[model samples]
Target: MAQDSGAPEPDDKLHDECGVFGVWAPGRDVARMTYFALRALQHRGQESAGIAVGDGKTVLVRKDLGLVTQVFSDADLAAMPGHVACGHCRYGTAGAKGWEAAQPHLSTINNVIIALAHNGTLVNFDDLRRELIDMAIPFRSNTDSEVAAKLIGYFTQRGHRLRTGIAHTMRMIEGGYAMVLVRENALYAFRDPHGIRPLVLGRLGDGGWVVASETCALDISGATFVREIEPGEIIRISDDGLRSERGCRPLTPANCIFEHVYFSRPDSVKDGSSFYLMRHRMGARLAQEAPVEADLVISVPDSGTPAAEGFAQESGIPFGTGLIKNRYVARTFIQPTPELRQMGVRLKLNALPDVVRGKRLVMVDDSVVRGTTSLQIVRMLKEAGATEVHVRSASPMVTWPCFYGIDTANQDQLIAANMDLEQIRSRLEADSVAFLSTEGLFACVPPNGYCTACFTGAYPVQIPRSFYEEKFLPGYEPNNLAPASKTSQMTLVQAEELLGQEG
Candidate 1:
């Protein structure tokens, strides 16, 4: 919610769960490395920080619900002295507050002490949770990482080594998930086969290697950027040396397109595409899909610029700074008052009276979460300028809430999921409005290589149908949790147990 660039705050807020950082080193400063990496990832999640260090058999963990500096003291990391370690900074897949749900979870079942920090959501969480519960596995947190750890334990119990256990871990569930796992002497890291989220490898000069949720973390840790962990690819770092293995059951690559538009840091490269450049392409594609004869292709600013340039290029319209953004705005815009969002729009963006005195202007934006901002911005453009105003969206309508870590689980809030494009355009009341066609949007990225689940209804992984629409409060039981009261019902839950919360 924080606007790092001091731009005007949009009516709707963007959502993300958090980022994780881990390191495997011999006589190396893993703790310091984690600290810097988490700092880099602070934008991913800001609610919690945790670190777990390992010395072969025994592991030391310090975790709490607070910012990295608030939760960890120099003494905390000093106490965790180890050769290999994993750490987490949490935002919440859906955990709004329950800070008790902070991660780097360690469940000591048998002699194996497994600690894991997860970055994305697991779609099969409820199904897997029920399956484990029926078998009497007790669960501790609401996080999908518990399911990840339990999955890891199942494979390790079957005598699979770190690599095989990790490879097998991908076979059980679905959705976007990247995890860093720590054991006695080795550190294992893996990404879901679809590669819906991102995980990267970095190497220190001392030969110590790191696995991070984003390249920004590697930069913060002063680690050299290595290649990305490919979708379904597994990497292991130990005394023997770093090795790669094929993991997840092969499937079409579906990296989350939203990552480039919003979630990831602009500097990081994901799946071989520059995040900023990808946005530029998306904007251009949007222009092609929804063209308008206008004086300038003004972007919403910040996140909307790259796409605006693309739109301008394709439309043959000169790209102009239609709106000037204020740079002093707070990083987060949790408006204290009811009309703060509207005020945020005004304070953040200013129409160029010189450029728009009588010009037909085209506006480009990333996504319209709710119609409030779209309506508001459209009105502002009409007031500022010329004859006609056209609105072009870079992505298709978002009809579904992402249960996998994105906080927009409240279905009632999503406008496109319920209304038709015509309805939305009418609601905004613009001269002309068009969304990027589904085909056009897909063509903007690699073929069939990103999670369009939010735009399309085809969920790549199996999740409890109820979960997407369920009223979930972290650490609360079903009796205490209320239903949304309007979502279509599917299967009912049977009292169940959990295996473990692993990845």
Candidate 2:
């Protein structure tokens, strides 16, 4: 018998890289606070969860291949008590999906110990890993995060302070990342130069501080939102005080727009507005751009609810629940036969005939990746007696692959990248299908620089030729917004030479 890999059935959805949480609080249960924060951020990643605590003397880490709830219990939390801690929930985009690949990754520098929780992919980590291997630095996993931890350890072992080592590592590594690191008595947080990922700073009571990938995590931990961690900024919190420093020069801001369209929880705030409102505005703009005459406006459950309500409000169509999702059906480790595998979507969602029967439904979804789920959902709705099923995507079409932190398919696998609007509608067998225009999407979010690479094919960070050479189909060229060669702000040789000069 073939053993199941315990991975979720392959679906047509873009996955965020991971979620990271860090807190510096004395005379409090920091581990439990981190656990609750990770639970709130469970939507960001589900494959693994881990927490590392610094109890003033040494750093302790516990991690495994499971959800946060599954990975820790009351006793587990009680065993690990600390003043500073960091946690991670992973939906891996970079390396193997195994116990060893789970983070917060731990590394040592002589007498000092540190653990790192990261949320993004490092584009140039392959070369950096090779360099570290050549220098005889051992690695426990084939993950960019592990490489990052080892790089910091290597630099710190060379007589530099931990913060200095981190700054040097920030200069040498390239990609979109939001990282939270913890040593025996201090907590550190930083972001990449481009700010392609999200990280927020929050105040916990009078003497504590917290940082997380989303504001929702702060809400769960009773932390008040302070502000976003600036691009290339490093924040350190310890007994002495909280301080901020520049890890590297900030590049042009390129926040991932998908966080507003999807990824983030509805209640999470960004730029003084909730993601629910942003998505609602996206649906309203979408309705203005692509209006369809339908008797009912229904969403694909939780993710698309706000958008569907906005569409209904804009189009004067009555909104109702047409599909019910089985909340418990997250992932199944069972191996099914071919015929049973075809019925996979049925295991997660079911159509409500009483509500949708004989009604013309405009089904709104977050986005269509490969169109497989949309097609199955359309057929299911029709089978449940929906008169006509018109599909509406709340966001613009995804035509290019995301290299920063999102786990999107290759260019050839994306439906919009390979087919036109009519072709997509035909393939899904829907009455009609329409997506939000890119301009309309921009109008819905706060005015700021964004990485529209997945929709516009214009990459903010330079992608290595060796990395993306075979990722695209023939004749589909990517627009490199940044210079094509060096992804890192400072090369490893330059950094090492600078260190030599300092010596």
Candidate 3:
């Protein structure tokens, strides 16, 4: 077993915002089910975990900064006795990372307690926050999800029902989101107009209702997969039954393509297609586009496994596990210092000398962000006696920042944006390197149904110039006094400080 190098692998890939799960089951242990379901969707986030359980008359929430396993204990789950529960696994996209930023943000609306778990980013959070703060609404965190919850609460407190408040809130917010909210007596789940995030509804064998970010959560909770919650639709569940209503008319179906390429767990299915199968198809497409002659095909396990299998099968090459991952090293407490990061790759994955001894290798990975990790992998394989390493990527090169809830907003940090394919291959010490074509990616989803903004620079929504500069280049002030774009407005932090003080 590879011992921990005293640090986790530094961030090398685009990160999804979060994962949400909610359950409404009167007789079942909804809290435990939520915990298990969140455990299944942990891949979506690792920064924080939270669970909010609501009985008929009261709601209790517990959240903290850590992995789900580290945040909640058996005693904690047992203490949360309720018929309704909402859980979240978070990786902050719109807010500064902190313990207080954990989700299932709780608020009171017309004295009705609302606890919400969100899995997307909102572009107009700053605008919405300005509106709410003007109404004297107090805020506890800087996250966009909290802004959204407050917007809904504001309307609910003004004589509107929960459903109507949510509808109005949806109209005011823009961007990608899949949300699950629990009230004192009922549970509500909804998707944004664009459906850039994934949310699915499932049925438990014991007459319970489950909603989650992926079907894998449903499988873990012993629930049968139900249909996906349509974009612009809101579903409410209570003792009476489940009811759905259109929250807003969808502009277009802009599902995040990264979900299929890298975010989702392989065992999970989305849009009637298995995530693993989609990666397999991407690999096959890569094989057809960039053919290579190698003795063996190896994956950068475990995200690289499906694509490598597809590459090997399509190319008629033998597939083998050339790298062994230290599963326990996934979420380590080790600090990611410069020295530790250089050693982190070796600690997470070690080359199998026996598998690659004197073999020409075709290595497949989901995608590359900085190329440092890829360089380390190629170096390790070469040190283990691999004659050659041909690197292949399953997704097209990511050259633009994602403003719809992914953590790839810095173009300078993106290796592909700064280097050509040959330059990248030279940096990684690979014999050759190739990425799947954008056309190949479009083939993986329904026509005009996916967002490839990061790869093609075709943003589905307008972005503010300040937003881009804030993520890509800090400390540089814009000379123009006007906003960056028509859609690019102030952020909540800026809006709060600028729109007069609120104590």
Candidate 4:
């Protein structure tokens, strides 16, 4: 479905740009299974959906720019008969959109079909893309996932086995990626060296195998959770069963901390910790770190409910849903004007005057991104006659952008980046505001087990300054992207010359 170009775009939330699901079930409807699992993981992305299925002899792929339900109909799933399948939901991390940017990205090598779905961003995408372009490898989309797929295809055609090819590509690529790829006979999954994104393996009751971005997908597919694919591990699944390899040397694991704070479903588990429990712990810690006097604890809804409950439990304040979310309203719309964008919040959530009237409220939310929504919601609560609203965030302030999979704002757009806690409180029109301390956040999770770079700017992966600028300025033309005077539209000779300079 096409978005209305004239509608105001909702711009409040942080979005993870992709989710991946894969299954190798010989006797099952793998395509439908993938559809269901993708639905379970849909919160990670919304721009597009795709599935690629493969039997022993043939691979079939269908993908489009829509929600998972809109893209794959029952008829479409029924037509794709296969023993192995991979699915993807995407949120357009790169500037590109439409059908062209949808995954599972398909490529052919030596008559073998390969379809891949990826869940993270590549920091060195320019370098890798330049290499592929110089080699005259045509690209279907402007996505780092395609670069990875083409590289894997290139190596497979050079006499390397599929697993070997993927392992080699992993070595050459830099940045966070959790990927699931399907070939005619098998399914392959791997994660980046830092594991900035989450991928987990699961077991089907009928002796099949599954791998997905989160455990919730397994639960929906009736698969039992097994374990997370290690930071640098690769696993291959075929009729002969599963095989594993250490694709790259492990760096300190940097599993995204936001997965617990926001991105992941509470039902999902990562790194042996339940995301729900971690979030609850985070809220409890927040209450300890920033105690507040309040008559009621209210949540922002859905994402904030769990933490709000924890805050209530720790503070001995009653927890109530003072705001109700309109489940049918889409998260985003094409708001063409700033005025309409500001009004869009009421369409998504409404304050309950009866619940909040004359009450001093402690409102717990997962995190504040740009602070626009926070201000709007606070103002809404005030209009409903709340005496005071104290904003409490379960996570430390997000002051930096995420370079992994998450679609975070540039530092300039982040409210915490430009203002202190008191300044943010004033801007949000709240009586008081406090965020979970960084140390409190670490205490809530496994020690040194996750990435807090968005809060601390301590990126586990070294990043070039240019990558940050490239995200907002699409078609970024830097000397590193092209050579001295060459543009991306240059011919093969120009790309080759650029590569030669790098060599």
Best by lDDT: 2
lDDT of 1 by residue, 1-503 (tens): 75455333435545678888889987977877787788778778777888888888787778887778778888777777789988898874435345547878887646878788888877656767776678687887666788778766765665346565566557665667888888778888899876777888999888889999888788777789888788888888889899888875556666776776677776777657777787788888887667777787788877778888889988899988878888654334243454554454776677777877688888888877877777777777778865777888887877666665677766567777666778888888777777777787767665546666677655555445565546432332222112221111212121111112333
Clashing pairs in 3: 464-488
Q: Summarize candidate 4's per-residue lDDT along 104-150 as a digit string, tens digits.
A: 99988878889999998887677778878887888877888888898
lDDT of 2 by residue, 3-98 (tens): 755444567688898999999999899999999999999999988999999999999999988788899999999999999999999996645778
314 in model 3: Cα distance from truth in Å?
Answer: 0.9
- Over all chains combined, what TM-score does candidate 1 have? 0.78
Task: Supply the TM-score for candidate 4.
Answer: 0.91
Clashes of 4: 6
**Number of backbone collisions per candidate:** 21, 0, 1, 6
lDDT of each: 0.72, 0.89, 0.84, 0.83
lDDT of 4: 0.83
TM-score of 3: 0.91
Report the lDDT tens digits of candidate 3 across residue range 238-327.
Answer: 988999999877667778889889998999987677889989988888899999999999999999899899899999999999999989
Give the residue spans of candidate 1 off by over 4 A: 1-14, 55-57, 66-80, 93-96, 130-137, 158-168, 246-248, 316-359, 379-388, 408-412, 463-503
Superposed model 4: Cα runs more than 4 Å off = 1-10, 331-340, 470-503
